[model samples]
Target chain A: MLLQQQLDGKITEQKDTGTPLLQVRNLKKYFPITSPFGRLKGHVKAVESVNFDLYEKGTLGLVGESGCGKSTTGRSILRLIEPTEGSVNYRGKDLLQLNQREFKGFRKEMQMVFQDPHSSLNPKKRIGELIEEPMEIHKIGTKADRMERAMDLLKRTGIREDQYFRFPHEFSGGQRQRIGIARALAVDPAIIVLDEPVSALDVSIQSQVLNLLEEIQDEFKLAYLFISHDLSVVRHIADEIGVMYLGHMVEKAPTDDLFANPLHPYTKALLSAIPIPDRKQRRERIIIKGDVPSPIDPPSGCVFHTRCPFAMEQCKSIKPEMLQQSDGHQVACHLYN
Target chain B: MEGYPLLEVKELRTRFSSEKGTITAVDGVTFKVDYGETLGVVGESGCGKSVTAESIMRLLNEKSTRYDGEINFKGVNLLSLPEKKMLDIRGNEISMIFQDAMTSLNPVFTIGDQIAESIIVHQNLGKKEAMEKAVEMLRLTGIPSPEKRVHEYPHEISGGMRQRVMIAMALSCQPSLLIADEPTTALDVTIQAQILEVINDLKEELNMGVIMITHDLGVVAEVCTRVAVMYLGQVIEESDVDALFASPRHPYTRGLLKSIPTITGDRSQKLHTIQGVVPALDNVPKGCRFAPRCPYATDKCMTEFPLLETLENGQKIRCWHHQEIMEREAASDVITAAT
Candidate 1:
């Protein structure tokens, strides 16, 4: 099949289906801790009831501190790790219900670009083979056709054709990342989960990579789950932003609105904490007290209540449900409730 | 000592002999940190910021790493100092906190033992007295329940807590000069803010000259009194924090500032980025180091190395075409006005 025909197939397929590209509802992934003696310890509620919708060509940015289940959410959505329970409605198909054999079919449409370019790619394989292997496994094209598309992907990702024969170690960090992006784009995925794609690169290279991602997004019309701890970086690309705390989606809103008027205490704290380059901005920073409670034994009621300044008696007992405000801005906090 | 700076590096060069070859990582970099002020040394990775700090501390093995030029501490040239004297200066007068809290700290030792070890070694206090002092130092760093935290190992504590412990250890001996090399990089934003505040408070209280080495311009603007922007192991630009942010002379400085994604900027706006990556240390470019990546590179910039020249506002710039750049900007503005 021709590249143009494959692209048109996607267009027709999207047109045929009225449902959102990906609809994740009440996604819960829990990991049970076991002692050395095989005794049941506690359950780490890594992702507790994560709900969000991703449209075609839209980018949803997940922002949180380290170990806040932002990365876990992306992995669970891709089913890279087994999500304990949830309905991952990928274009009307419930992805979570599918077994390993069945999930393999959906794997082509949902791809991932990892953080470290150096370690992500298999060292033994040539760069060309790395990109070609995915399509070869999916049986999308013939050997010659797959090779051609891989080279095309290399060119589209701004990598030289000659470098495709080179090993991963030969290229610079930025160039290696381009190869990673090229590999992710090889399958013509509908949505890509980019986990800290630009964090490992330098500031100059970060912008370059970010610009490339934006251009690619425009050209391919693909949705992106841009997961990063950098709020500023996320603000630049993300349309909708979700602030994760412990294991819950504390706040969800449009990027501009969230940055402008953050309702949840955690969201407000997160926004205020970002160090603006301009000293003259003089924004008052809200430093939350203590570390995030261990996921194996998370705090009761509101997980953020221990660190939250406005925590009251109600917050310490009853968990605050996500209250929908005007214009799809939802915040889960007792203060808002 | 009347007019002397607290710490000053004059034409400092650091070279490491590896299997490949002897590569000059930090080439003739010079800067000064005065008493009770923080001098922010800002640069990207491989720009020799950390190497410069390490050179000042004499942390590199003298066998493999060769140092040229002078490192003056309290009006005394430390290059001539013997290993015995240098050992005394390491934690007593000069202290460094590195980037990674996870690896920099010993996982086996309790937090109290580590902090107290530094105290006992430098201050000559008994283990019992040093242990008490360790708790005091932890408390000063704003660690909640220092008594409990002191008993925990490096792994038991969080990243932010480990960093706090590192700072407490660095400050235990009342070091006049603190070289914090990316202290907040491994931490979250809120924790970074906290760490910066703690450093600021301690700097003021002790009146210690701080050499804050970081890649973050935001941290520089917040904490530093003066800033030195380095590229490929040389100080390309040096100005007061206000002046550096207000009017960055070097193209690299401007590019870096613009490259930083800010929440204040228009969403999804394409950031201004320098064309190329930092060259490998072994493959350092001749002439102006930034010529390859610089947009303003001319024949002169490519051929001849630009000397660090102090400008009218006491801002230092190392660019052959900075004057021409200003003139061009003026001309372009006039042209736009005429239109």
Candidate 2:
């Protein structure tokens, strides 16, 4: 009651396009390990002090290898998992401070689409009911209105309305992903965190899904937090790309700038390792020397120094801050300094 | 194309008996793998590329699988070989590696014991000799500090090192033929590159005839000398790696190549995708299997099946309208270049 009273009438106010739709600062999510009996063992710092902003209709792509906490970062932003420390500012309001009942009101504008569409949807529910369940929970419309809106969303997502009555198991992987996208858009969300949306689909179906996402983002001006491991897919959709390594945002730059001028040793190694489709366009591959260090007791100072080819003695002892490069690009490596 | 191949598979058909019926996973698959050459079998899942590999290895259970073909490995017919003889040839003359090393390697045993077990079985070496050779094999796969890693279990090592351990076990006996099925699929890209480089280097050192099975065309372009594109149960197209990418003869192959987003190409355009998904294995098509999703499919394609015919440039295609495909692709090439 006090939180709502503090907000008063400003809760529903819309901000101008000049401001970022979402601003996250010093975000961290550390899972504490417990001993078999009861005592705290250690901490798995899955995500540590990440910061970024998403403008209206903008997508910030997060790229990293498996177990790098890209998925954890996305989940933390939506408060699916409680953050250890950070401030998620939405139009000047701090989301981290919101209580359970207060955050419920913000759920309409913030949603997430998971990686595996097969497991994300309820197997028993019809596609129409699945898409309409969100609007019904939020009480945005009546039964009839929700059904009509569900049909419209089905059409928008390129699924036929007649097929909406079918169960989840009846549809193919790509079609199921489309239904997943429609469900995310059911409550008219301003921002959606898509976690490896196309990784499960085939190459051809992956393109179809990516094109649909681009089209929908343009139509609704939706801000997206697209997380994927494939650099090729991330470059096509994201305006700005952030490279994560052992829970750290090692590099951040515009998509074109990141690919063309990768400064971080880990980022450069990742780019060079991607296998080119064309046989003739050959380039030297910089295969990192060793496997990724364990996140439990990650290498001190810099997590990537174990595999980095250009690691200096300072990288082992002193941690580097995310320092600014030219024109919004940022790199967290001692070589840049 | 050259002298006698180290291994040749002809008219290879593999069928599994299910509750529905007997479904032929690989039908009339024919290919030749030369010494020191890598032949990439590229396809989507359920496309029988892995079945082709397993069929050659005779790894599938004979009670459930019925195979019809001649898998001649250096003048020996693998199909008609005795069980004892086949056992002798499995790891000694030919070897196999799987995709997920975590599941493939035994968790209870140390990496050294698992690798040494193969050497003991194949080379008839005793415990001490095989253990020493296991370390040497692990070192050959580029595992650093092989002496220490030899005592570690599969779970203690990283995924990349586990994959390298699997490779070490597979190559310990120095088999002349190695069949690697998506060996690097479970690793990260940099680790995948390292594994591929190691595989290529070993292929040269051992002069092995490798049948590399994977779904990645990029991996195919990087390491494969020749490529075979598989559809539901057959090789749809086969050519040199350069030629297959330059002028893909089959519609499915061409569509597969175009669907992947290329780093060198323009990002403004949407990818060209095949219209439909792969048909179910139970519902084997009556005619050209890919006809339903192929744009240039004709009435004749729906009724008559095409055989694999060798093209003028040593490329092989299994399509009735090769002439039309050539013409249409050439015209589209000019259109794309003009734009």
What DockQ results do all the predictions give, each relative to the true complex? 0.54, 0.42
lDDT string for model 2 (B65-95, tens) is: 9999899888778999988899998988899
Interface RMSD of 1: 2.8
Docking class of 2: acceptable
Which portions of model 2 show Cα errors greater than 4 Å? Answer: A1-17, B1-4, B335-339
Runs in model 1 lying further than 4 Å from the true structure: A1-18, B1-3, B330-339
lDDT of 1 by residue, A146-209 (tens): 9999999999988888787999988889989999999889889999999999989888889989
> Model 1 misses residue A267 by how many Å?
0.9
Model 2 chain A scores worst on lDDT over the 10 consecutive residues at A6-15
